[model samples]
Target: MNIYRYEENPIITPADIQPYHKGFQVIGAFNAGVAEYNGETLLLLRVAEQPISDDPNKVLAPVYNTGTGKIDLVELDRKDERYDFSDPRVVRDVTQNATFAYLTSISYVRIARSKDGHRFTIDNEPFIYPSNEQEIFGVEDPRVTQIGEDYYIYFSVVSPKGIGESMVSTRDFSNVTHHGMIFSPDNKDVLIFPEKIGGKYYALHRPTMKSIGTPEIWIAESDNLLYWGNHKHLLGLRQGMWDSGRIGGGAVPIKTDKGWLELYHGATMEHRYCMGAVLLDLEHPEKVIARSAAPVLEPEADYEKKGFFGDVVFSCGVVVDGDIVRMYYGVADTSMACAELSLQEILDSLVYE
Candidate 1:
């Protein structure tokens, strides 16, 4: 497939916001989903923030608590047998034989306006912030889809209990009505189809599973938007492949005559991420007609090759105009970027052969 990256790469990087609390500092604010609403571009960013450790030379950290609305500090003696902080997945306890849970980190949506989808001007403040008790940590990875007269925003709500998918609706962009959480515990990366199918709402979700099932894309149906059920697995990682690690929906599904085309991100066993495609049957979305045998986009740019996490090209949203699909993705976990490919070309690249 032919991929064209915007000259202005790394569209949005983490900018230091005014501190939420006295002692905490939020950084590494990057990776956003894209949408077009009211002749403006919308970004749903997964802004990562961490607090300053009490000891400047030490690694001991404090986790934030939403229930009591306080920050809980946890001292981890690396040399002690009770703490094991070696694993990249999470910090573990070798002596205690348990995981060392940290305080919750959070994210919020910051609106950026772009006339040409390349150069953007970010707003001074966040569009949405964590207010409710359930959103103790923060909201993350927002996907915006315009349906009918309302703009529907799907995001991941993180808390101490588990990470869940939530939805919010907006008509004027200034005010939003929180519809609460849609999926159950241990689910995220939700992308709603741009239009309704068979008179019901369809969404793509990654149900986080520890064993038996890896992180794969799944589809669910809802009659009233709040409750989701009738889930069917959509795509999974192939053994010894580029996407052998995991896969999840990237942009909201693009509707075309061929099928419902979805651009998704996949990773390898080593956690290197790339982009791919999946085509579902128009009427029966549960039926996957075709998928990408090879990656449509990889970490080719230097910006994508190095950052907070290297060798990654993760897309949260895209814009489709006629035959071209312009995608805004996070490069190397640090900054935002843009790329373009034809809709026909992406569909043709799918492995239906």
Candidate 2:
């Protein structure tokens, strides 16, 4: 595929975002949801922030307490033998056999606006944060779909209950209505189609199964957009291939003459993430028309191969303007970047067999 990355790649970083609260430091600003609103390009960025501590030996995790209605910082001693801090993102308690863990940083969505697609000015305050028990840990990886005048936001809500999909809608970006948790635990990467299909709204979701099942993409339909049903498996992990580990939905599926063009992310068992495309039947979205035998985009750049997490390029949204498709993606779980591909070029690259 002929992919052209922006010269000013890594467009948004932690430095662009201010901490949501005092005494906290912004760690990452990535995985943003893209949209064109009010004659400007908008990015709903996932900003990760962590509590800053003077003591180097102590690791602090910011947690939102529902009862207290405030964020509490939990201090974990680095020398503590009861926990494992092998991963920079999470701290696992050894006593529970690593069954329990907490994120080093709490993530929330913030807005960044740009007159041109490349340069952006981020808002000092967060656009969305953890407000209820369902999102006590944090809210993450948002995908926005504009339906009529209303834009629906689908994101992952993390808590003790497990990660699930939640819905919120906005029109003017000033006022938003939370529709609560729409998908149950252990599900995420949910993206809704911009319009109704067969007189019902449709969505693509990924539900992770711990035992016998691998992480795969699934499709569902709903009449009211809140209550979804008629679930069907859409795609599965290709063993020994680039996406052998897992696969999930990315960007809102782009509608075209050929089919619904979906730009998604896949990973190997080695944890290397790449972006690829798949074409689904327009009328019956559950049917896969074509899939990319090779990744359309990969983690080849130094910025993508080294960061908070390495060897990853995951996209949350894409904007189609005529023949050009601008994809906004997160690099190595740390910062935001943009790349462009011809819409027809991607369709031609798909393997039918």
Candidate 3:
């Protein structure tokens, strides 16, 4: 798989962004949603911030206090046996059975503008932060779909209630209208189609399973974009292959003559993430036609293999100009990077079903 990585990779990083408030520090600036507004390339970045704490005896977390409408820090004693520090992202309290009990960092969607697609200027404030109880944990991995005059945005909402997907729409990016949670708990990686098909809207989502099945891409159709139904399992993991563990929708699926080209991320049993391509029927996106055997883009660079979550190449969006596919992706869950691939090359690499 030939990929032309930007010479100045990691166009945005934690060090490049300032903390939203004083006691906090930016730890990650990645998993951005790509779009074009006013002839400028736009990236809706997921900026993660963690509280400053040097004490070895204490672990600090960020929580959105719904009552006060502000994020407050929650500190726990490291000596406490009940605090499960297994996942670096969350300080899970084994005593409680509920998720989103405590998160190590809180993320918000911020804008980063670029003229040349590689060089970006990070914005000061968050474009979309945790505004409701459902977003108490944080808003993350946003996917934007432009239809007519409106840009419809949907993202993952993490909270004590459960991890779900929510929707928001904007035209100028200055103002937004929140449409509340579209998909319920334990479901995320939702991507709405750029346009409707067969007089209805389409979407791709991932529903994580606990006992019944594995996480795979699923297709859903809606009449008004809010009320969604007719969900069908679209893509499943290929056992013993690159995407054997789990898979999720990445980037808004690009429309091509070949099919609805979807660049998705898949992880191994070891949690190593890589990017691959799949082709779906344009008229019937639920019917996938082709997919990659090996990853088109994987964690190979030193920067991609080391940081917050190492060996990961996850993306939320891409920009397709003519035959060139410019992919804006997150590396190691720490920084934003860009790479270019041939549209024909990616399509040719796929195995037709």
Q: Give the candidates in order of TM-score, highest first.
A: 3, 2, 1
Where does the lowest 10-residue lDDT sum fall in candidate 2?
A: 96-105
Residue 28, model 3: Cα distance from true site in angstroms: 0.4
**Candidate 1 lDDT, 1-353, residue by residue in tens:** 78888876776666534545456565555668676767777676666656666664334454546566565555555566565656422455555556445432446777777777776777666676665655666777788888888888878776657788888898877899989889877898898887779999899999999657789989999887788889998887899988998888888888889889998999998989999999999998888999999899999899899887799998888888998898888888777888999999998889882
What's the lDDT for candidate 3?
0.91
What are the RMSDs of all candidates, in order?
Answer: 2.6, 1.1, 1.2
* Candidates ranked, most accurate by lDDT first: 2, 3, 1
Q: Where does the lowest 10-residue lDDT sum fall in candidate 3?
A: 92-101
Model 2 ranges with Cα > 4 A deviation: none
TM-scores, all models, native as reference? 0.90, 0.98, 0.98
Relative to the unseen true structure, what is the C-alpha lDDT of residue 308 in candidate 3, on a scale of 0 to 100?
97
Q: Would you list the clashing residue pairs of candidate 2?
A: none
* lDDT score, candidate 2: 0.92
